[model samples]
Target: MQKKMIKKIRKRDTKGLDYVINNYSKKVYYLVDKIIGFYGREEVEECVSDVFYELWENIDQFDEKRGEFSSFIYMKTKYKALDYKRRLEKKEVHKTELEDDITNKITTEHIVLDKESSEEIIEIINNFKEPDKTYFYNRYFMYYKVDDIAVMYKTTRASVENRLYRCRLKIKEMLEGRK
Candidate 1:
């Protein structure tokens, strides 16, 4: 049934498409909100709709056995939110400061993982909830410094640093276990 639905959607069968959309719309919206947070209710709605359009556009590329459907949708929303964040950064008038920050972070902290290792790192990080995952991504992938992460997370720099240090150690352990 799942394969048939996917096939129908790929063939442009409207009814099958509608069935999938109707079933998955709320899940997609919740997933997007989880990734991007509540900017505003309307923006949240649009982001979810954007995810669906992306999913529909690329539905044929989905591989069922590789991941859960929810995970696939979550990843799609996550990438979209990251792209939106980059767009906002590009629009900033304070580009020099941003560039300087990027330079400083790159010169300071190291990215410990290669491509395959990074995926394993993500799997470990996904085990965290709420502010933990948010904090980890902001600190590492987005390269926000401890002070910046503290401001965003409304915590002290020491606390943010501790969480990041532990999260990194946890990810390293998880990757080691995979060996």
Candidate 2:
């Protein structure tokens, strides 16, 4: 039955898709839920649906030489669920970043005079060398608390502040055409 279904689906038969989904959706849903159940029922349902769609799209990658077709489907479902889990984790981190009051205050109070300069300055800081870039961000962008950064980097609090200050000052001078 599995071989017949795979053959029909491989031939682009829609009923074969229905057969596979009917037979396999339970296993797929169980795996997705187990991996990312914390994302809530709605996301779990959506992940199950996406897994089926991916199984259909990637049917050609199945290799009889390697393993059974059901194993292939389950593996794909596992990877898709893991991918969803990673994306959700990143969303939480970004949400935390946005909720940082100091970051918001710095973002508002220091706009670099205009949108274009703001973009350019951001570009410049992103390209700054090594720990300087990280230090600049520790002080300004990420709200790392200078004391905490000094401890983490194994440096004096004043040293952290001064390096960060020089980085900021370079951007300031460049923006003012003083460089």
Candidate 3:
């Protein structure tokens, strides 16, 4: 049934896709607004729109057996919103050097492959231990970025970068071993 739905979507089944978009767009908008706020409303709105485009483009990748599609969409929108927020916060820094510092600090070193690989990557992220895992989720998963994570958790951007580095390396190693 899920496969058939995915096939229908991939076949340019506008009605099927519309069913998804209509069912999910409100939730996406609410989450985006809640997380990104109006201070930088344009960026948030743009990112929310991007998330929907991504959802439509990648709809066939979804696997209902693993989890509910709505949860996946929620998480993706949340991350995109966070990324928007992170970019806006960095814009507040003003200095070119500071912007560079922020960019390097929160960079995501991971590459998402096909659905199976993405699922594996998510599983590895889920395996992280407290504080480190939560911090990581807040940073990358939420798109908090390094500087924002530092401010939110009362730490330094350098420290957050180090955490991200370690987390990335750890996940990389885990994924490599799984291959």
Candidate 4:
């Protein structure tokens, strides 16, 4: 089945693309979702479509002797998903900085917190343990979601969430004691 589709794709028959997408959309989607679940549904759908586009464009590179077409598609989907995630991260960082600058300029008269409290909060965050500190910085400072952190740490989303919850409670207790 894949050989026939490959042949058609090599011949530039559009139906070959259709056949591959129809047959493997779910698998591609699964890979994309696993890699970039922090992205919205539309973004994930766009990534899946980008995977198909990649496969279509690189049809000639698909050597049957190297491996299966399914494997090639899976690899391409994973790479594309990671690439998309990196691009989003870079863009988000710039966007956040720009927004912060604008907000600071607009709110000069309405500072959200005094300098001392902000410094204390930073100290608290810096004092957190290894992976927990990293997780907290990624989730709060860098604005990463639980799913993104899970992928980064190679752990489950539930585990990340539970750890974050416990960390938050601990921080709350510490802050309450300080007051």
Estimate, for each residue in 95-142, the C-alpha lDDT of model 2 and write its tens digit.
774666456446444756554556788787988897899988776667
The TM-score of candidate 2 is 0.60
TM-score, ranked from best to worst:
2, 4, 3, 1
Residues 5-34 of candidate 4 have per-residue lDDT tens digits of: 899988889999999999999999988988
Evaluate residue 111 in candidate 2 and report its C-alpha lDDT on the 0 to 100 scale: 55
Which digits, one per residue and each the tens of the lDDT, describe model 3 over residues 101-179?
4554444443444235577777878887766787788866676756778888887878877777788788767766777
Q: RMSD in angstroms, all models?
A: 19.1, 9.6, 19.9, 10.2
Error of 3 at 137 (Å): 42
Winner by lDDT between candidate 4 and candidate 3: 4
Which residue pairs come into collision in candidate 2?
none
In candidate 3, the residue pairs with backbone N, CA or C atoms under 3 Å apart (3 or more residues apart, or in different chains) clash, namely none
Q: After superposition, how far is residue 76 of candidate 1 from its true place, in Å?
A: 1.2
lDDT of 1 by residue, 5-87 (tens): 77887887867667777878877777667655535577677777788788778986788889876677678888887675566
Model 4 alpha-carbon drift over 4 Å, by segment: 109-179
Please give the range of 10 consecutive residues that has the lowest summed lDDT in model 2. 100-109
TM per prediction: 0.46, 0.60, 0.47, 0.59
The candidate scoring highest on lDDT is: 2
